[model samples]
Target: MIKNYRMVLEYDGSRYDGWQKQGNTEQTIQGKIEQVLERMTGQAVEVHGSGRTDAGVHALAQVANFHMDGKMASKEIQEYLNQYLPEDIRVITLEPAKERFHSRLNAQEKTYLYRIEMGERKQVFERKYIYGLYKSLNVEAMERASAYLTGEHDFKSFCSNRKMKKSTVRVLKEIEFEQQGSRLLIRYTGNGFLYNMVRIITGTLIEVGLGQRKAEDMKGILEAKDRNQAGFTAPPEGLFLEQVRYNV
Candidate 1:
């Protein structure tokens, strides 16, 4: 009998191309996992991720699922994966999942975290994960700008895909900011996000904080629906796929 398995993974994406497996290379998170599974099961396996994180982006809790013909115990599978996988990738948990459970399709919500360091001094250990800005930003202005972004709207201006044929509308449930000294943590929770949408929003908010744009300008940018109207796309290093939520 075939058994479906679910896993929660955490990976440092600095060296990975992304979550999706490509034909040309095996330097992706999905590719690495699939290769290991194929070796373990002695069969080709297709592993599906909750979403595709951009290159250089990290993940604290990325969900994935796959099917195997043999009945391997969850603990055994997890141990085998951890043993064979690279040091940067880890299988936090592995368990039997419902036959129809799909990590991407059944996702109800996803939260992404972006980290910014606003100071002259850069962190040595966290240099790989945080975005460092030389100057401090106006926190109040960023907050006002974030308020405009928290709602259902056409976020095409913030999307990087110009030839996107599908709908660009998305529901941004929340945008919260927490400041700790020179470090700023921005959290975004949404039903789904467009390609580079969160990074673009972060850029726009940074512009507002930098006095390049007013907080109220966000409304017009959203209405314009033109990608050029948005700010520059923030670098991928600061972004992390924090979590994925499901109804069950």
Candidate 2:
């Protein structure tokens, strides 16, 4: 009998290429997990993730599902995977799922976080996780710009994939900004996101904070639907796939 399993994962993606399995010898979070599953089950297995995070990105919680013919307990599988996986990758939960459940297809909402450290002092320990900026950002300006991004819109300007064929229209449920001393955190929740959407939006907001772009330019950028008309894409190190929500 085939058993379907749902898994919650947490990983530090600094060393991996990305979430998706790629060409030969390219290390990825999916590739690593699939390899370990194959070793444990003695059968080839595919782990489907909720989203494809870019290189250098991290995750607090990511969901995936896989089907295999096995009799192992879910808790046992979780422990088994953790024993063989790398130090940076951890299995937080493993449980059986309904037959038709899918990690990506069934997802209802996803939250992404971008962190910027503004200070002259270098963050040595957090260098792999935070985007360090030397200048202070105008928090009020960034907040104003974020308001324009919270709604359904064609996000072609914010996406990095120029050859995208899918619909760029997506509903942004929330866009929040918080500051604690030198640390600036930007949170985005949406029904779905295009390639590099959060990163590009962060860059654009930073530009507004720096006075390089007016806050009202966000509206024009969205209307333009051209990637070149938007601001730069922020570094991947600052991004984290914070959470994924689904209706059971």
Q: Write the per-residue lDDT of candidate 1 for residues 1-248, one digit (tens) a residue.
A: 99889999999999999899888878999999999999998999999999999889999999999999757789999999999999999999999999999999999999999999998866899998999876789989999998988989999999999999999999999999999999989999999999999999999999999999999999999999999999989999999999999986
Clashing residue pairs in candidate 1 (N, C-alpha, C atoms within 3 angstroms): none
Reference-based TM-score of each model: 0.98, 0.98
- Collision count for each candidate, in order: 0, 0
Model 2, residue pairs in steric clash: none
| Total residue pair clashes for candidate 2 | 0
Against the reference, the lDDT scores of all candidates come to 0.94, 0.93
lDDT of 1 at 172: 98
Poorly placed runs, candidate 2 (over 4 Å): none
Determine the C-alpha RMSD for candidate 2 after optimal superposition of all C-alphas: 0.9
State the TM-score for model 2: 0.98
Per-residue alpha-carbon lDDT of candidate 2 for residues 135-241, written as tens digits (9 for 90 to 100): 89999988898899898999999999999998999999999888878999999999999999999999999999999999999999999999999998999999999
Give the local distance difference test score of model 2. Answer: 0.93
